[model samples]
Target chain A: MASNKEDVKLLGMVESPFVSRVDIALKLKGVEYKYEVENLQNKSEFLLKYNPVYKKVPVLVHNGKPISESLVILEYIDETWKQNPILPSDPYKRALARFWSKFIDDKIINAARKALYTHDEKEREKGVEEIEEALHLFENELKGKFFGGDEIGIVDITAVLIAYWLPIIQEAFGAKLFTSDKFPKLYNWSQDFNNHPIVKETLPPRETLMAYYKGHYERHVASNK
Target chain B: MASNKEDVKLLGMVESPFVSRVDIALKLKGVEYKYEVENLQNKSEFLLKYNPVYKKVPVLVHNGKPISESLVILEYIDETWKQNPILPSDPYKRALARFWSKFIDDKIINAARKALYTHDEKEREKGVEEIEEALHLFENELKGKFFGGDEIGIVDITAVLIAYWLPIIQEAFGAKLFTSDKFPKLYNWSQDFNNHPIVKETLPPRETLMAYYKGHYERHVASNK
Candidate 1:
């Protein structure tokens, strides 16, 4: 399976949760790729051409073909390279993993994105309720160690990004929603996922992330105010 | 394979777009499932039991283990049944299908739902731009007849639901969006999909769906205003 392929490049920013999702996926599969950081405020021409639709970061380039969505890129990474496979071999199990991943992607994580900067009372509350309700289900349904039962897989990756990033966002915004006591299972799982060697090495330092987010939150607040 | 393996029941509503994605997948696969309509506004015990998290529609109950999320249900359908396969066996092809499916799911179709009901002009434009951008990609990327290439498949199901549903939604709100000239590929594809014998037989009539959405839209606007 080892072969020299086309030049692989990644268009992303350091602080993007969305970009981080793709970064983690690529690292997990041990696929070699060039990382080209994109400025979200002023996107590069290549980033714009590669991903004109959303114009978001974490756009992966493989043999000159660009796949923008993180989840999509994850699947492509797994498919194109056989080493360090991401998806399970069993079809049903794969489906289950994908389901939980989609659940996290579509609802819990996306819902939390809105809650981060929402200053309006009703909007913030709506976002909080959405997160709380979602976490309640996440805590209850995932009785096992990981979303993939005993194994740490793609769903685990999706959930982990939220867990780690959520706290940073919360701290930046002064909104403490994900308490250890409130979501014990999720809390522990987050710790476990972060502790993994691959995850440990790949993640940007918390202090760095926090510092970046501090400026981000201040800008957001000032603009809104 | 179709011996006596319990009943396959789908809890969904005609008005719900997420449920519609699952329905199209099921229909395309030719998998027989008992459709149990659930009104989300008036939450049902069954709905809660089947999907406690979102409590939304498009929950597929297979031997009592309920799987929610339309994309998740679509994957589950493809995995469980070998009849008419929705996903391709080739990994790269499968990834392409998933990429486009997730792309459309995240941006175009799902975003449109919020746009239809929002009174805010900015929010409305956000939704419209999302749909427009997605359609542009769809028209450009889909060089063949279907998003699935020659025949109908996952991307077809995803595209069909969004394109056709737009008109129904427009009818409901006394507006228009799905113009023929604007999105030639997606618009024409919607027609082909809707006109197919299988799709024609299964899909709800446009007039029926239009009438259903009209009342639904009016009530929300009146109350919200």
Candidate 2:
């Protein structure tokens, strides 16, 4: 690993899976950086200035230049730091990785969010069905131990939500969508991914995440009533 | 330009701006390839097979390996054929380009689509407002002759819809959202973009697209009534 001297700062909310994705990427690359926790409810001026468009977390500021959006930031990190490359080297394989990463973002995460967060019963049911169908398609793409073969690549990093947050949200809300039996490959992959030393170290404590999601579930139920 | 020997096939619909984005990228790269039209309403089995996840057009098949999504295809083309690079050489600039490209897809295009296609009056009004807001932010990003600083890069290519199709759709639907006076920079960029030789040659004929969108507008109105 290359010794880093560049000034890198991550503006993030600790509980965000998106933030964790950036954190994990930095850890994987062995890049040293400053971490600033942003209170999402009351976003800091620095966060807003860095990411004026979205005003969202997981904004990676490198040498004073800010890059928002976790996936975009991941690509930036991969391109900037050549060590422990996250994406495949081949152009075609890289394209495939980008495709699946996008699928996880556009379809799987969106559906999962709806399933866990939406107040409408019908929409939640539709979200559950949609997530199941999307997961099956994603499951078919998993031919190896990790989406990046033996190593956790961009697709696996992008799918941090599936490995860590989804189960917590599912359990917190008492939603029964993703299961070991229903998606054995994905389940196994998730277990392997979560158990990875880097991932295990980088991820927030399970009990903290559980309490956070459980609070969200409680609030959701209260509002729905 | 490197002499092309690889078999490249693009399965696309004539009227789609997304497909046109890929077409223009290939043309810019000077890559000779086969074009296979797919009727979206009655999709070809080949397209379904290649892009089973999305089942959408603009699937670039390079040496029998399929890559779907226009932006993904654009990056693949840039990487595969290094002749005329579409993205920036620098990582931060590339991230900025990716960010704007995504903003175009996620915010501007979605709002433009809803404004042009939605049957609901309230939704259409909201879409119009949203697109105007989104376009203003995009306009601020324009500091050079083109988004690529003299060449039409990925961000400009991704904004093909805003350039070639939006005017036609606006006219066809008799909606007034994107205007030169309101968004002079974006409007100028659109004009410069559409007037480019490759873009002009690759885009579907004006009359054909106008008629197509007009038909859609008529049907939308009829259905609402």
lDDT string, candidate 2, B79-178, tens digits: 9999889999999999999999999988998898888788788998899999999999999999999999989999999999888888888999998888
In the range B114-133, model 1's lDDT, one tens digit per residue, is 56777887988787776676
Tens digits of per-residue lDDT for model 2, A31-132: 999999999889999999999999999999998999999989999999999999999999999999999999988999889989888988899889999999
lDDT of 2 at B157: 95
Per-model TM-score versus the true fold: 0.90, 0.97
Candidate 2 TM-score versus the reference:
0.97
lDDT of 1 by residue, A1-225 (tens): 535956788898878767777788778777777889878778899988988777888898887877877777777777787676678877666776777777787778766867777768798888888888878877775767776667667777777666688888789888877889888888998888888888788788888889988897899889886
Inter-residue clash pairs, candidate 2: none
Residue ranges of candidate 1 with Cα displaced over 4 Å: B120-130
The lDDT for every candidate, in the order shown, is 0.77, 0.92
